[model samples]
Target: MPATAGERPLTPAGRRVLEVASALFYERGIGQVGMELIAAEAGVTKKTVYDRFGSKEALVLAYLRARDERWRAFLDERLAAAPSPRERVLATFDALGEWLRAESARGCSMVNAVAEVPAPDHPVHRVAAEQKSWLRGLYADLIVQAGHGDAGGLADRLALLHEGAVVMFSVGAMADAPEIARDTAAALLP
Candidate 1:
């Protein structure tokens, strides 16, 4: 059983379960972490975990949602502080770089989750897809605001650059990937 859209808010105990499970899922892989471990680490019983989240799959969805929300808030803050649309676009990558260094040196959490969870129809997959869509939309909107023509096309290119930098940075193939991406973006902007 999974949580519905109208599901009631998480109880304090449920929140604890999410907190513990999110850390574990991000630190470990989704497939690697079991509900039992999450329950144990959360200081709750297995039944409580199931009772709160309904299922392991639901818990995974909750974890991804929590991560995505945090990321959006972080990126939004950085973008808000930028003086120009172009700077806002670049600030996104800057935020990503900061996030990579501070939180997830391993890689993008959504990407990691996508790699681990192969089922395309899974709720986790939808969450991952939603994150990517949101990012591309943000880039498109910013590019248009920056007075760039063919905003959609440029947005796609920028999104690729952004994702490439994350992959390169995660694999240690490019120490300056974020800066490089920003430089490439500056050239791409009209």
Candidate 2:
């Protein structure tokens, strides 16, 4: 979790719990993992898990948010290395490709979470929606920075390609899906 003012940093045990839970949650479905398992894997008591995270739902949210922070930082570094706004826009696909091969072997965390937590009213849905919104908004900003028209429309299209590529890569077993997305997005852009 990003340290907010007045919020104490995670204790060593808390950090361990988060790390263990993160792996378990991603490797196994959320419903399959329990607090007992998390505590056992983290070498903490069940009480410690509750003391640190309050509830299972809260812990899941923290895990999701932490993953989101890491991804944003990774994409930011890739975007910064690019020379122009257009390159930066394309950089997202390159970053996604690298991310898929290096980190996201199982697929998008948000998408997976949304599938597991299917209720539209669920907090997981909100987080997944927010992540998609951020991607679309990022595309829009890059489009405008490149002095392109229809930023909103183009951003929406790019976001779809980006998302579709992930599903194709993870579920369809298309290893080159991200490159395909990049090429398709390039054709869409001015």
Candidate 3:
């Protein structure tokens, strides 16, 4: 009988593969990690992995999709906790700074993948761009809703700081990137 949609595997073996893939991608980057290494790490044969994800690109996309969902969820959670629209607008940078400080966190994986993928027509690049634009629009809307007279200006400024902080922290800049980001965010907030 053929396997069901969700019934790939439930034993320890399945978890091991995902755990290894996650760590490898997080550490060495997706472009550098290969299926052979993944299989070795998972104690499974290459055929098994092929059976699972079908292709390296598929695995990469799956990783990115999962990352995107988690990021959206985290931002939604933070917005829920924010007391006002102004706070919601500023939370983007504050949350970004906090996320960057994680020991295991390497900068945005989607951004990294886009940089490497290099094809504007690629689905991953399209998804990444959409995710970024969505966040920017979210901040802009929050700023407008907060009655800030210059909502577009505020959104543009915060977006620059947001992208700058990520790039700075990713490149091993000063240890105070997050603090600087928060301060900048406070200034942008109404």
Candidate 2 segments exceeding 4 Å error:
2-8
What are the per-model numbers of colliding residue pairs? 0, 0, 0
Top candidate (lDDT): 2
Error of 3 at 134 (Å): 1.7
lDDT by residue (64-150, candidate 2, tens digit) is 888899999999999999999999999999999999988888999999999999899999899889999999999999999988989
104 in model 1: Cα distance from truth in Å? 1.2
lDDT of 1 by residue, 58-114 (tens): 888888888888888999899999999889999998998898888878888899998
- Cα lDDT tens digits, model 3, 114-182, are 887898998779778887787778768888888988777777777777777777788887556766877
Better of 1 and 2 by TM-score: 2
Candidates in order, TM-scores: namely 0.95, 0.95, 0.81
lDDT comparing candidate 1 with the true structure:
0.88
User: Candidate 2 — what's its lDDT?
Assistant: 0.90
Show pairs that collide, candidate 2: none
Relative to the true structure, candidate 1 reaches a TM of 0.95
| C-alpha lDDT of residue 5 in model 1 | 46
Task: Sort every candidate by lDDT, greatest first.
Answer: 2, 1, 3
On TM-score, the leading prediction is 2
Backbone clashes in model 3 = 0
